[model samples]
Target: MCRGWCWGCGWCCWAWWGRSPPSCRRCSTTGRWIICRPVPIRRGWRRSRSSCPGARRPSWCLCITGTVGSVPPIGRPPPLRSPRSGSGIGWSPSRGGVPAEDGATLMYPVASNGPGTDEKLRDAFVERVREVARSRGGLTVEVGGPGALAADAGKVYESLGGPLLYTTVGVVAVLLILIYRSPVLWLVPLVVAGVADFLSMGVAYGLNQAFGTSVSGQSSAMMTILVFGAGTDYALLLVSRYREELRRVERPYEAMKVALRGCGPAVLASSGTVAAGLLCLLAADLNSSRGMGPLGMVGVLCALLAMLTLLPATLVLLGRRVFWPLVPAYGSEPKARRSLFSAMGSSAGRRPLTVLAGGAVLLGALALGTLDLPGSLKQEDSFVDRPESVAAMRTLAEAFPGQGTQPISVITPAGRTEATIAGIQGHEGVAAVERGRTGDGWTELSVIAKGAPQSAAETATIESLRDRLPESYIGGPSAEQLDLKDTNARDRLVVVPIVLLSVLLILVALLRSLVAPLLLVVAVVAVWAASLGIGGLVFGPVFGFEGTDPGLGLLSFVFLVALGVDYGIFLMHRMREESLAGAEPAAAALTALRTTGGVIASAGLVLAATFAVLLNMGLVQLVELGFVIAVGVLLDTFLVRTYLVTSASVALGRKVWWPGRLSREPAGPVEQPPGETPPSRERVAVG
Candidate 1:
C-alpha cells in the first residue's frame, strides 16, 4: 500500500481497501457465481435496478451460480463508471457472484498499463519547476543575483557618470570662455587639456589591465578635473608669455621658441612637483588611494608632456594667429605704474602687512568650518542626491531589518581546535553570522555589522570584531582595505619629506639659492594649511561635509608647492631682469609686479575657474577639493604674488638673491638709462 492517497489518472481511491476488501466482491459455490459492489457515492446519486429486476425472488439462489468474476451483488446497487476510462460498468453473474453460505470476498486491484502514474507525476513536477524558474529568470543561480548590492552600485554608477561628466565639462568650458574673453585663446588650453585627459586615461587603463591596478571611481573623476585645470594652467602661462614675446621679436617662430625656452623649465618643475606629490599617494594603504598615486602621476606627466611637446609644436604651427586679431604688435614700453594692476600692486606693497593680515583673517574665519566635520562614510553620502541605490537600500532595509550591508569575513583556522564559532554569534555589534567553507579543515565567518556598511562605525565594528576573534581568525573588511590603510599612513610620512626635498632640489637648481627654497617651502606650507583650514570650515560646518578628502590634501599640497614655485620663478626672473637694469630694491619689486602681475592673475583665474568645475561633480570629496585648490591658486596669485614675495624682496633689498651674488647693488634713485625707459609704455607678451 502507498503511504498516502493514490490518484490513478483522474480516479481517486484508497488503494489497499479497494483491492482486498471483504465487503465489496464475492464468489458463489454453485455454478461459480460472483458479484462486486461499487464504492459509495454522494447522497444525490440514484441506484439503478436493471441488473437484478426480480430482486426479492430468491436473490440468494442466483448468487449460488458458482461463477468467479466481477459482478454486482444480489439486492445491491450497480457499479459506477470509471471517470478516466469513460467506460460503463457491467457485471456478469456468470463470471463472479456472491452466495450467502460461501462468505468469501474476491478483490481485484486496478492496474495502469499506459502512461503509468509515476511518469505522469514526474512530468507534472518538472513542469511546475520550469514555471518557477522561468518566472524568476534564473537570477538566483548567477552572480549578483536580483537586488544585490554590487549590482545596485553598478547601475547607480552608470546613471550618474553621464550627467556628472556633462555638467563638469560644460561648466569648465563656460567658465573658461568667461575668463579668457578670446574664443580662439580659449580652445587652445581646452584642446591641450583634452589631449592630456585621453592620454592619461589610456595609460591608466593599460596599467590597470597589465598590472592589476585599479583606481576608485572618485579618483578617476578627479583625474579628469586635475588634467583639465592643470593642463589649461600650463598652456595659459606659455601662451601669455609667447604673446608678450611676439611683440618684441620680428618672427613668430622666434617668439614661440623664446616662450618655450623661458616657460619650459618652470612648467617642467611645476609638473614634476605635482607628480611627486601624487606619487606620495603610493604610500597610502587604501587600494583606492594607492591606485590614485600612479593614476594622478600619470595625468600630471601627460599634461606636462603636452605642455612641453604638443604645446610648443602647436604654437610654432599657429604663429601670430594663435592669439588672432588681438595680437600685441610693436609698441613702446608700457607705463608700468599707470596700469590698474600696477597701482593695486603699488598700494599692496605700501601696506603689505595689512593685506597679509586681512587675507589671513579671512582664511581663518573660513577655517572655523572644519570643526563640524563628520566622519561617516555612508555610500549615499558619496553621491549628490538619494540615488536609485539609496532607494533600493531603503527597500532592502524595510524587507530585512538589521541586515544592513555586506559583512566582513573573519576567517579562523580549522586546525585551531581551541577555537569555536559559537562565540562569534554573541560578538558585540555583529548582527548575523554566515559560515563559509574554505579548503579542507578551514572555515570562515562573515560578521555583518549593525549599521551602514561603509560608515565609520562599521569600520570600527570590524576592528572591534577583529580584536574579539581568537588569534587564529584573520579579520578585516578585506585584506585589501587593511593594506590600503597601512599604505596611506606610511605614505603620509614618506610623501611629505620626499615632496619637500624635491621642491627644495628644484628651487636650488633654478635659483642656486639655499635660503630661497627654504623660504618658499615655508610659504607653501603656510598657504596649504590655511587653504585646508578654510576648506574644512566651509565644507565641515556650513555644508555638513566630512573631513577633507585624503586625496584632496595630497593633491593640493603638490599643486601649492609646484605651482607656487612657478610664481616664485616668475617673480625672481623679473627681479633678476630688473636688477640687471640697475634698479633699486623697492623699484625692482615695483617693476616685477607691474610687469608680471596681470599675466599671473589672469593665469591663476583661468586655472582656478577650471578647477572649480569639480564642484559640479556629485562627490563631496571633489567639491571640497575643487574649492580648496581654486582658493589656493587665487591666494598664490593675488596675495602671495602681490604682497608676500614683493614685501620680502623689498625688505631683503640687494640681499634677496644672496650668496649666489645675483642681485645688483642698490643704486639710489637712478634714472632710466638709454633704451631703458621706465617700462611705462612697453608691450609685454600675451599668449
Candidate 2:
C-alpha cells in the first residue's frame, strides 16, 4: 500500500485494492491516505470487484489544490467528483502540467522501502513503459525520478559485471603473455589468479550473507581487479625468483622451495601492507567505503593464498620445461647485460641530491593542479554517458524552474502529527504541504518547497525543517544526498589518519628502519597528491566530466598510498639484504635498485593496466577513480621509486637504516663465491 503526491494538479491520492462502493464523501482531516498503487505491469489495467473477496474496503479521498474531493474507490474510475461544488479550486490539467502530452511521472513522497519489492516494482514499471512505447510507434517513454534512477543504476551495474570481468581477464592475459613469453608458463599464473578471483567472490558472498556487510556493485568490481592485479604481482615475484633458483638448484622441487624462501617474506609483507591499508577503511562511516575495506582485504588475501600455495604446487608439478623455449639449465649463468634499471641506478647514485630535489619539485608542481578540480558531482552527472533518466531529470528541472518537483518528507510520530504540521505550515521555504500515508505509529507529510530540487534554497529548507522539528525524521532524495556528502566528509577525516598510521607501521616493521618507513610514506603521499592533481586538470578539460566524485579523494588516497608502498618494500628489503651481506651503503642502494627494479616496473604496469580498465566503465566516479590510481601507480613506479627513493638512499648512506644496528656497524665480512674475492670498499662507494 502506498500514497503519492501529484504535482500536476496538486493532488494527494491513495492507491489500494479492495471491494468498495462508488460514491463521494467528505474525508475527515484526522484520516490518512494509505495503500498506494504499485507501478503496473500494464497500463489501464484495473482490478474487478470479484478479484478481491470477503475483505473490508478501505475508504479513499483526494485533496486537489486545497479542496476536499471524494473519489470512486478501487475497481471503478469516474472523473474526480468535483470537489464539494463551492470550492473555487479547479481540476483542470494541461500540457504544462505534471503529465506531458504523452508521458507522466509517478512521484512517491517516501524513502525507498529497501531492495526487495520496491526494486521489482521499479523494474516492472520500466519494462511496461518501454513495451508500450515499442508497440505504439513514434511514442517515446522514459522512467525518471528517484525510484527509476536507482533501478537504472542497478541495471547499469548488472550489465557492467560481464564486461568488466571479461576486460580484466583479457587485459591480464595479454600482459602475462608479453611478460612471460612462454606459452605454458603464463597459463599457470593466469589460471591461479582466476581461481583466486573465484575464491574471493565466494568468500565475499559468504561474508556478506553471514555478517550483513554491505555489498555494492562498485566494491564487487574492485575486488575482481585486486585479485588479478595484486595476485599477478605476487606471482611475478615468485616466478622470477623461481627461475633464478632453477639455474642454481639441480632439482625442480628444491628449486621451488628455494624460490619461495627467497621471495616469500617480500610477498607476504607486500600483501599485508595492502590489506592493512584497505582495512583502515573500516573507520569510514560511509557504507560503500566501510564495506569496500573488508571486501578488498579479502580479495588481496585470497590472491596471496593462491600465489603462495597453489602457484608453487602447480609450477613444481610442471618442472623446468614449463619455460621450454628459454628453460633455465642447472648451473648455467644468466646473461650478464647492462639493463635499463642498472643505468638508472647509476645516474641517481652519481647525483643523489640533484635527483632527489628534482623529483620532489616535479611532484609538488603537479599537486598544484588540485586547485582546478571541479565541485562535487551532481546526481544528474554521475554517468559517463547520460541515460534517459538523467535526460528526464534535466527536462523537469528546466520546466519547473521555481517549484520543487520532488517533495521533502517529514515522518513524525502519529501522536505528534499535528504539532509537526503546525511547525511546518509556515516554514520559510515551504510552498505547499500535503498529508500522506499513516500507519505503524508514524504519519508522513510531503512538503513542496519554493526552491527547486537540490538547489541551495532547497538544501537550506531541508536543514531548517530538521532543526525546527527535532522529533520528526526529515528525509527525501535531496536530504539523502546531503547526508551522503556530510558522511563522506566525516569519513575522510577519520579514515585518512588510520590508513597512514597503519601503512607506516607495516613499512617500519618490514624495513626495520624508522627513517626509511617515513620516507616511503611521505613519497607515496606526494604521489597521491600529484595523481589527484593530474585528475583535476584532465577530468574537466580532456574528459569533459561535469565534476569530481565525492569519494574519489578518500578512495584514491587509500589505494595510492597502500599500492605505492609496495614498490618501496621491494627495493628497501633487497637493499637491507645487501647491507646485511656486507656491501657498502651506496653499492647496496644501487644493487638493490638494479636487482628489483625490473620486477617492480612490471608489477606496476600490471596494476596500472588493470585499473585502467575502469576507464571503460559507465560511471563517472569509476572512471575518475581508475584514472587517478592508474596514474599514481605509474608515477610511483617510474619516477618516485626509481629516482627519489634511490637517491635518498644513496645520499643518506648507512643512515637510511637509522638507529638499526646496520647504521652503527661497519661492513661485516663479505660472503664471496669460491675463488672470487670481494671488491674493496673504495671501488663500491659512489664518487
Candidate 3:
C-alpha cells in the first residue's frame, strides 16, 4: 500500500515502464500498426474480445523499470467474459514484440502496478522473480526494475555486515597492539569498546522499537564507527595518565584513582562537546539526518561510560605486569628524550609569529580548492560501486534517448484531483500522466517527464508542479533528493551557527577566556574548511568521484570543530595547570605541548584510522566523509594543534589566558628546565 512517492535517499527512482496497448487483439499482431495506452494494474478493466489476424489468442508480455518504491503487479489478469456467456474468456493479447536485446526493440512505454518499496515485500518479489528466471533459463524474463536493485542492495548490506565488523575489530586490534606494545594490554581496550558497541546497538534497537526512531544502514554504520573511535580516544587519555601516575602512586588501584581524577574533566568535556554537537542534527528535517543524532549520541555516551568505568576497572584488575617489559618503576622519572613535539615547540617558541602566519596562509590556500569542487552527485553516481539499480538505470538511459523511466508522484487531496491532473498535464516537461491508487483523502498521480530523470528540465517541472498544485506533495527519488538538497541548505543556516556557538560557549566556559576559546574555535573551523577544500581537490581527480555530496560540508564541519577541540582541551588544560603552578607563560606553553603531545597524537591517529574505515563502504558519500574527517584529524594533529596553537600561545604569552586568574599571576621570564644550561650564540635555548 505504498500510495505515493517514497525515497530511500535520492540514489534511485523506481517506476514500472513499458509500451503496449492495455489489451490488443491477438489477430492484430500480423498487422504492422501498434499503439500503447496507459494500463492500470487494478483488479478489473475492459478489454476487446478479438483474435489477432494469424493467432488464436492475444499474445503479450509486461516489462518494468523502477526502484523499490514501485513495481508492477504479478501475473496477467483473467480475460473479461460476456454476461451472457459465463464460461467464455473473451480478451486477446499480442505476443508479436521482438526479443529485447540490449533494449533494441522497445516501442511501447508504460508501467503497471509495481511491487512497492518494502523490505519484506521486495524480498518476496525478488525471490519469485528468481524462480521465474531460473525456470526460463538464466534471466530470460527481464524484470528490469528497482525491486531487483533494492533486493540486491539488501543482499549487499547483509554480505558486507560480517566483513565490515571483522575489519573494524581487526583494525582496532592491530592499532592497539602497536600503540600498547603489549599482548595483554591491547586486548582490554578492544574488548571493552566492543562491549560498548554491542550495548549501543541494543540501545539503538530499543530506541527504534520504543520511540519509532529511524534506523538505516548509513546511521548504524556511523554509530558503530563513532563508538570504536571515540571510545579509543577516552581510553588513550586515561591510560596515558594512569601510566604517568603509576610511577608516583606505587599501587595500581591508587594510580587508577589519581589518573581518573586528573583527566576526568577533560575526557568528560570532550565527549560532551561531541554529543551536544551531534545532537544539533536533530534540527534537520531529513529523517536520515535526524535519526543520526540519537545514534551518534548513544555511541559517544556508551564509549564514555566504557572508558571511564569498564576501561579503568579492567586495567586495575590486570595489574602493572600488563605493561610487562616497559613497566613504569616507582619513583623513576621518565627517560629524557627530545621528542618531535619538543622540537616543534622550540621552533614555534623561537618564531611564533612566523609559524602562526605561515600555517594560516596554508589553510587559506588549501581552502581555495573549493573552487574546483564539482556539482551535486547524481543518484547513479552516489555509490562508489554501482548496484543493480544503477546498472538498470544506465541501461535504460542508453535504450531510451529522451524519456523518463521513473515516475514523479504528486499526491493531492481527492477533491482537487482533477485540477491537479490538469495543472500537471499543462506543465512543459511532462511526457505522459497516469492516475494511480486513491486512499484516505489522497489521489496519486504518476508523471513521466519529457526530459530524463534528474535533468534540469525535469527539476524545473517538479518545482513548477509543486507551485501549481500547492495542495499536493510532489515526491519521488528525484524529488526527495531535491528536498534533501533544500533542507541541507536550510539546516546549514540554522545548525552551523548553533554548532559554532555551542562549541564556543563550551570552550569559553572551560578556558574562562574569550580570546583563547576564540583562537581554538577559529583554528578548528579553519581546519574544517581546509579539510573540505582538500576533499574538493582530491574527490574529482584522485578518486574520480562524480560530485560532492551536499551534506558533506555540514557533517564535516560539525565533526572537525567539535572533535578537533578534544586535543585543544587536553593541551590547554595542561597549559593552564602549569601556568597556575607558577611557570612562565612561554615555559608553560612549551611544557604542556611536550607533555601531552604524544597522547594527543596517538588519540588522533586512532580516531582518524577508525573513520578511514568508512572508505571501504559502498556509498560514495561515506567514502567522501571518511576521507575528509581522516584528513582533517591528521591536519589538526600534526599541523594546527601541534604548531599553530602552540605558536599562538607562545606569542600571546600571559594574554592568551586573559581575564583568567592565571594571566594576572604570571609575569616571570621563561625559565629553563632543571639541569639545562644557559643559551649561548651557538646554541638554541630549550625551555
Candidate 4:
C-alpha cells in the first residue's frame, strides 16, 4: 500500500503499488508523484497526462480523492461512480458495485433447496453471510429480500410453538381451577386435554408424512388450541353430568357410565359438527387452508376420543372424592338455588318474541361493522413487530422511490428471448431489463419496474406484463400475493357453501329436526358475521393493525361456525331431552337453558380464553383471528345461546322441533312423584 499527499491539489491519495511499479517518477508540471510502470490499461481505466514528455503514468493509479487535477479537501472522498465505469469500486456504490468508502448490496438467488423452507439451510446461509461480512473489516451485512423474509417468518413460527403451548396450558389451567373450584378436579381435565393435544400433534404429523399434506406453524398452533378448547368443553359437560349422576347412583363407576350415557350423544354431536365443518376446508383452493382442514379435524377427533374414553376412565378411577370439599355423595341431593342461568331463562321465557327480536337486531347491527374493516394485509405488515427483512424493504422504498428493489421474473422461450425483452422494455412501468440465465429451452429475464414493490402501481405493471406476454410466465413475491388474494376469494365462494351444508346435515341428524338444525346454523352464521364486524371495528382502531389478513375472513368463519355450534348443540340437545321427558314446550326451553347454561358458560370461557392466547402471538393474523373467535364464543355463549336461542325455542313451542316426534306427538303427562319438586337436575355452578 502507498499513501501520498498532493500539496498542490490538497488531496490524499492511497493506492496499492504492486511490485514497486518498476519505477516511480515525479511529474515536472505540478511536482506530483506518479507510478510510471507502463501497465496496460484495464477496463474503466483512463490515461492521465504525463509531464515528462515520453513517460506515462500507470493506469492502475486509482484515486480515492476527487478527479484528476481537482483541489478537493483531504478528508472528503470523490462522488459515487456508475456501476459500469469503475474497477469494482466506483459504480453507483450500489448497482452491483462497492465503493472503497461505503458498502455494497449483494443478491443471491437461492435454489429450491434453499433456506426459505429449511431451518438448517437458513441458519447456515445466515451464518455464512455473517462470516463473509466479518472477514471484511468494518463491513456489516443485513440479509433481506424474499428468501430472508421467508427465513424470518420461519424463525417466528419456530419461536411460536413453545411459548404458545405454555401460555395456552397456563391459561386453561387457571380457568379450569376457577370454574371447578376444586383442587383435584381440574387436574383430570387438564391432563386429558394435554394428552389429547399431544396425540393430535402426532396424528397430524403422521397424516402430513403419509398423505403429503402441507403443515404450517399457524395450522399446528390452531390444532393445539382446538384439542384443548373443544376437549375441555367435552370434559366439562361430562364431569358436570357425572356429579349429578353421583347423587342419584350408588357407585362412582355406575355414575360415570350413567353420565356418559346422558351427555355422550351431545358430546358426539358437537365433536362431529366441528370435525365435519373443518373438513370442508379441504375444498379450499389455498394450500394452507386446505391442509388445515385435515389437521384441525384430527385435533377435534383426538380430543373427542380422549374425552369420551380416557377422561371417563380417569374420573371413574379417581372416584367421587375427586370433587373434594364440595363432593356430591351418593343419595345426597343438592340444595335448590335460584342461579343466574335461571334468572336469564326466566327473562327469555317472559318475553320470547321481544327477546328474540332484540337479539336479532343487535347481531344484525354488529354485522354491519364488516364494511369498516381494513384492506387486505401486505406481507410487510403481517408481523405484529417488524423484522429485519421488512425494515430493509422500508429502507429500500425510501432510498429508491422510483425504482423497485425486487425483480419481476419472466420466463420466455429461448428462441424468442430478444422479442420478449423488447416487448417488456416497451412497457411504461419498466425501469430496466437484464437478461438472466438461459437454459435448455427457456430464458429468464429480470425486469425492474419503476414503481415500488407491492405498491398498486407495481401490481398493475405485473398484470399488464402478464397480459402482454402470454407466452411468458411472470412471477415474483408481489405476483404470488396477488394470486393468493384471488385464490382466497375463490375459496370462500366454494368452501363456505360446503361447510354450511356439511355442518347443517350434522346438526339435522343430531337434533332429529329440520327446524332446530336450521335455527342453530343461522345463529352461528349470525355470530360469525357479528364477530367479523367487531373485528372490523377494533382491529385497526384499537390494535393498530394496518390491514386485515386476506385469509382472516375465511379462517375465522370456519372456526366460529364450527366452535360456536357446540354450545347450541349442548342447549338444544338438552332441550330435546326435556321435551321427551314429558316437559311442556315452554318449560322444556326454560329448563334446557337453566340446566345447561352454567356448563355452557364455563365451556365457552375455557374455549374463548384458549383462543385469546393467540393475542399474545407475534403475527397480526393470529391476533385478529383469535380476537374474532374469542369474541364470537363469548357472544354465542352468553347472548345467543342463553337468550336468543332460548327465546326462539320458547316462541316456536313444539314448532321449534317441527316434524320431529316431539312436534307431532302430544307431550306425555308429568312423571314427577307427588312430593318431589319436579326432579330438576342440578346445573354445574361456575362461580
Candidate 5:
C-alpha cells in the first residue's frame, strides 16, 4: 500500500542498507539478498546453504533481495515462508536483534523440541535467528549451534522415513524365495509378517500413549526387525512341518492340525521365551530400556499371533499350489537332500567328546574379545553416520573449546532457587548461570559448564552440583547418557538373572528335565558371551565404531539367550520325542539332529538375516545390536545347536535327561517273535 526510499537500491519500507555478501545467495523463499554481517564475502568463501540461524546461532530474516534476478516486493506483502525449508536462511533487522559482527560471536540458544520432533518450532527458531543476522549486513554471519544441526538432521531423517521398511521387506522376500525355493511361498509369510508389523505398531502406539512408554526411532526399528525376523522363523518351522505332515495326512486341514501338534510346542516355547525375556526390561531404570520391554514384547506377540493364525490359515487355503515346482504331493515323501546339518551331525556323532571339547575352546576364545570392546559411547558418537547435530557439535567443539553448548537444566523448589543457584555458582566447573521459567512452586535454572558438554570435566561438575543440591534435579543429554550407563549396569544385575530363570523355567516345562534345561541355558549364555566378544574385537577395528552402546551387554544377552534357545528347543524337543518313542540316548540325539536339523537351521537363518537389517540403519546402537544378534543367531544355528549341544547329549547318554522318566526307564523291552531272543544292551550300544 505504501512505498518509501529504501537503503542504496530503491524504495523500501525499513530503510535498511548494507553490502550483500556475494557468497550468500538470495533467500529461496523470497529471492532476497542476505547481508552476511561484519566481513564481506571473500572470493572463495565456502558457501554452505544451511546458514539458517536458530536460537543458538545469530538471528536472520527471509525478505526478497532487491539486488537479485527477481524483483523485490515493492508494495505486495512478503511471501509466506515454508515451514520446512525456509528456516533462518535470510536476515532482517525487525525480527531477532542485530546480528553480531565478525569476532563478536553471540551465545543465543533455542529450546528445541529435538530434531525431527517438531517441524514448526525448528522453522520458527531458525527464521528468528536469520533475521538477527540480516540486521547487520556485510558481516560473515556465524549461523550455527546445536539447534541448527538437529534441524538439518531432522530433515534428513524425515526424508528417509519408512523407506527402511520397504528395503527390509525386499531383503526378506529374496531370502524367503531362496529358502522355500518357491516364489509363491514367500508371499504368504511376507503378508502375514506385514500384518504383524502393522498390528505391532498400533499396539506400540497405544502403549506409548496410554502408559507413556518412550517410543524412539531406534526401538521402533528394532521392533520391526524382530517382527520379521522372529515371525519368519515361526512361519518356516510351521510350513516345513506342514509339508511333511501332508505326505501322511490326506486333507490340508488335517495336515495343518498334525503339523501344529508336532512343531507348535517348540514354536510356542520360543516365542514365549522371547516375549518373557524382553518383558524383563521392566526392571530397567532407563526410560528407553524400560519402554523397549513392552514394545518388544508387543512386536513378538503380534508376530507369534500372525504366524500361528494368519500364516496357517493362508497355507491351508493355498494348499498344494503354494509349493509350486517343489510341491510335496500328498502321500509323497519329501526329497532327501544331504543337508549341511546332517553333515555336521555326522561329525558330532563320530567323535562327540572331541567335537564338544574343541567347540567349547573356540567359544571360550571368542568370549575373550569382550575385554577389547571400546569404551562407553559418547552422545555425539552415537550415530553410525554423522547427522547435522553431530556436525554442529563438532564445529562448536573446534570453534568454542572448553564451553558447554547444551544447558544443564536444574529444577528446584521456588523457595530454594537462590540457594541452588548460589551452590551451582560456587561449583568448580560452572561458567555461567541463567535463571529461567518458574511455575507451581518450581524454578528452572540453566547452568553452563566451563568444560564442553559431556566432557569429563562437565561430568564432574554435574555430579558436584547434584551432590551439593540434593533437592535440585539436573538433567540433559549428558546426564541422560550417564544415567543410561549406570542404570544399564544395574539392570543387568537384576534382569539377566530374571531372564535366565524365566528361560530355564520355560525350557524345563517344555523338555521336562533339569539337566536338559540347564544345558540349553548354559549354551545360549556362552553364545551370547562369544557373540559379544566378537563385537568387542571387530566393532572398533572393522566397523570403526569407537564405543559400544551402554545397553549392549544386557540387550544382547537377552536377545541371544532367548532367540538362541529357539533352535535348541526344536532340536531338544525332537530328541525328547525320539527318546520317549523308543530310541536310546546317543541314537535319539543323532536322530533328532537328522530329522529336525534342516528346519532349525533354516529358522536360524531367517532370524539372523532379519536382525542384520539393522546394520543398514543410521544409528550405531542399531548397527552394534544388529551385528551381535545376527552373529549370535548364526552361532546358535550352526555351531552350538548343531554340534555342541548334540555332542553333549550323545556323550552324556541317559544321564542327559537326568531324573526324567525317559532317563530312569530304559526303552521298553521289544517284543520279538517266539524264535528270536532279545538283543543285549551292550550289543545295541556297540552297534
Candidate 6:
C-alpha cells in the first residue's frame, strides 16, 4: 500500500478492489471533501460491504498523492472514510469553497512489493534518460580513464633532481677548492657550469616549444648531470694548462692564448663524441628515449661553448688571480714525482698484449648479463614505493572479487545479440563485464580480470581474447596495450643500432682515425657490458632489487658509452702529444700518464661521485643507473685509460697514428728559436 498527503487540499482517498458503496458518495458532495486512507490487502483479498442511503461507489482510480488516515481492517489498518459535510469533518479544498475532486487529475496505480524490482526500475529510468539525451544530440564519452603521463614525468624529475645536482656540484666544488686553494678557482667551474646549464635548458625549452615535442623528466635530470660533469672536466683541463703556462710564460694573456691553442681541440673533440653518442636516442620511438637524445646533445654543446668562450674570457680577466693564495714560484717546472697512474701506465706499456687480453676477458664476461636482462613496464618497477595511487589500487583489489580497479575494454558494434556478450563472459580469466553504448552504433564492454592488470599472464590472456573475440566484437584496451608493448620493443632494437652507428661516426670524426675509432667503440662496449653486468649482480643479488628497469638500461647504455669516452680522449690526446715530441714509446706513455693522469682521475672522481648520488633516490631505476654510470667512469679512467690505452700505444708504437704520417723521430734539442728562452736543467723539455 502507498500513501501521500496534499497540504492545503484537505483531501484524502482510498480505493476498494471490487465494490462501490454509500461511503464513496462522500467524495462527490458539493462544498465538501473526502479522505479515504489506504489499507493493505491480504491473500486473495476480500472486502466488507456497507450500505448507505446516499451511496456512491469508491473510486476505481486511486490518487497516490493524498493522505491516508488509516488502513482498512483485514490484517491491516482500517481505511479512513471522512465525511463530505462542512465543519471539522470536511473542509473545502479551495479557500473559495470548491470541492477537492473538482480540481483533481486522473490517478495511476503503483506497485509496492517485489525482489530486485528497485534495481530494474532504476536501470529503466537511466536508460530512458540516456535515450532522451541521444535523441537530442549525440554525446561522447572518454574510452578509458584520465591520462597520467604528465604526472609520471613529474615524478621522474623529482626523483632524479636532488642527488644528481647536489652531489655533482658539491664534489666538483670541493675538488677545485683542493687543487687551487683559492676562492676564484673554486668558483670558476661552478660559474661556468651554471652558464652551460642555462644555455642548454633554454635551447631545449625553445626547441620543445617550437617543435611541439616533449622532453622526458629523466632526460632533464641527465642533462643537469652532464652539464656539471662535462663542464667542470673541460674547465679543469683548460685551467690547469692555463696555470702551468702562466708560471712559465711572462705575459698572462699570451699564456691564456697558448692554453686555448693547445687544449681547445681536445676539449672540442671530447664534447663532440659525447654529443654524437647522445644523438643516438633520436632513433627511439619512445618519447622518453627520443627526448633524451636532444637533451643530452644540447648539454654537451653548452658545456663545449662555456669551456671555449666564457671560461677563457673569465680566465683572462682573473689572470694569475686564478691561483692567488697558492701562487707558484717564479718559474715552476712540471712535478717530477711519479704517480701511481704513471707507474701503472709504465707497466701496461711494457706488456701491451697481456694487459689488453686480460682486460678484454674481464669486460667480456660482464657483458654476458646483458643477454639475460628482462624487459617489462610494470608501474611498481618505475616508482619508489608503489606510489599512493598504486597502494589505493591494491586496497580496491581486496574489496573487489578481482584485480582491483584495472579495466580491460572490449568494443563491439551496437545491436549485437545478447548471445555475443554472454560468450565474452565465458572467456577464461574474465571476472565481470559491464556494457554501455557509444555513439555511431558502437558498444563498449569493460571486463574485470582475476589477476593483476597488465601482468604477463594477464597480457597473455588478453592476447588469447584478442584472437578468440567474435568477428563482430572487437578488443580495445587489451589489444592496444599489447600493441604499445610490441612497438616499444621494436623501437629499442632499431634505436640501439642507430645510436651505436652514430657514436662510431662521431668517434671517427673526433679521432680522425678509422682504427682508433673502431678500437674506441670496442672499449666503450666493454665498459657498457662490465658496468651492466656488475649492476645486475649487485642490484639483484646483494641489494635485493628485482629486474632492471628498461629505461635504466637504455639511459645507462648511452651515458656509459658516451661519457666514458672522455677518459679515453684525455689519455689518447696526451699520449699523441708526448709521442709527437719524439720520446720512446715507454717514456711517451709515462709522460702522458704523468701529465694528464691527475686531472683525468680527478674528473672521474667528480663524475662518479655525482652519479653515485642517484643511489639516494628511491627508485631502483635511478639506483641502477647511478651506480652503473659511476662504475663505468671509474673503470674507464683507472683501468682502460691508465692500463689499456697506454699498453696499446706502446705495443702499436709508431703504428698508433699510422697513415696520418706523424713522425716518430724526436724534435731535436730545445732551441730558443728567436725570442723564446731555452730550458735550464731545472726545467724538463716538452714539445
Sorting all predicted structures by lDDT, with the top scorer first, yields 4, 2, 3, 5, 6, 1
Give each model's whole-structure lDDT.
Answer: 0.54, 0.72, 0.69, 0.72, 0.69, 0.58
Output the better candidate (1/6) by TM-score: 6
| TM accuracy, model 2 | 0.81
lDDT tens digits, residue span 1-687, model 3: 011112111101111110122211111111111111111111111111111111121111223333212222343333333333233332222222322345442322222233232343444445554444335321223434444545555555444445566777788888888888877878888877877776676666557657766655666777778889899988888888788767767778778877787789999988998998888887866666677778889889989987887778777777788877778788766666667788989998999999999999999999998888878877667767776556656666666656676667666677888888888888888987877656556666668788876778788888888788766677665676677788788878888899888888988898888878888999999999898999999999999998888888888888788789878988898787677667788888888888788888888988898888888877788789889999999999999999999999999988899888766776333454332222110011111
Report residue 209 deviation for candidate 4 (angstroms).
1.7
Listed in order, each prediction's TM-score against the native is: 0.68, 0.81, 0.80, 0.82, 0.78, 0.70
Q: Candidate 5: global Cα-lDDT? A: 0.69
Report the number of backbone clashes for model 4. Answer: 3
Best of the two (2, 4) by TM-score? 4
> Which segments of candidate 5 are over 4 A away from where they belong?
1-107, 111-161, 209-212, 412-422, 435-444, 669-687
Clashing pairs in 4: 81-92, 82-91, 83-91
Per-residue lDDT of candidate 2, residues 1-687 (tens digit): 011112111111110011011100111111010111222211111122112122111111111111112111112111122223321211111112243222333221222221223333445444443343334233233445565566566666766767888899899888888888878888888887877776676566557557766656787778888999999999889998888777778877777777777789988998899999999998887777888899899989989987887778777777889987879899787766666888999999999999999999999999998999988787778888887767766766654567677777667777888888888888979987766656556776778788977788999999899889877777666777777778788889999999999998888888888999999999999999999999999999999998898899999999999899988998899888788878889988888888888889889999999999999998898899999999999999999999999999999998988878889885586675432223222111010
- Cα-based RMSD of candidate 4: 19.3
**In candidate 4, what are the lDDT values of residues 1-687, reduced to their tens digit?**
011112111111111121022211211011011101111221111111111122111101011212212222122122222233332111011124212222233332222211122233444444443343334333333445665566567667767767888998999999988988899999988887877775665565456546766566788789889989999899999998888878878877777777787789889988988999999998887878887899899889988987887777777777778999788987787877787888999999999999999999999999999999998888878888888667766655554565677777776777888999999999999988877656556666678788977778899999899899987777766767777888889889999999889988888888889999999989999999999999999998899998898999999999998988888998898788788778878888898888888999999999999999999988888899999999999999999999999999999999989888889875665565322223245465443
The per-residue C-alpha lDDT of model 6 at residue 31 equals 8
Give the least accurate 10-residue stretch of model 2, judged by summed lDDT: 23-32
Better of 3 and 5 by TM-score: 3
State in Å the error of residue 189, model 4: 0.8
RMSD of 6: 25.8
lDDT of 6 by residue, 1-687 (tens): 011122111111111210133321222111011111111111111111111111111111112112222211111112222232211111101111111242321122111111111222322322332233224222221111111211332344544545556766787788777766787677977877866775665566556656644464455667777888888888878887777667667766677777777678888888888888788777776666677788788888878877777677766666665676765444776556646665777678667899988988888888786665555545434555554333433433333323423456555555663655787688777776765434344555556566565566667767666677654433333344455566556666786677678777776666555666666667877888788877766766676664666566677878888887767787677666655555665676677787788788877877787677677666666677888899989988888877777777677776666545443344444443322332212122121
Q: How far is candidate 5 from the true structure (C-alpha RMSD, Å)?
A: 15.6
lDDT tens string, model 5, 1-687?
011111112311111111122211221111111111111111111111112112122111122222232222212123234465543222212212211232233333444321222344555556555555445444433444444544443443443336667877887898888887776888988877887776676566556546666654556667878888889888888887787666667878777887777668788888898899889888876666776788789889989887887777778777788888787777665554565656778789889999999999999999999999998987667767775446546655654678776677676777988888898898879987877656556666767798987788998988888788877667655665666677778889999999999989988888879999999999999999999999999999899997999989998998898788877887888788677667888888887887777777777887888788778877678789989999999999889999999999999888888878887877665564332223221110000
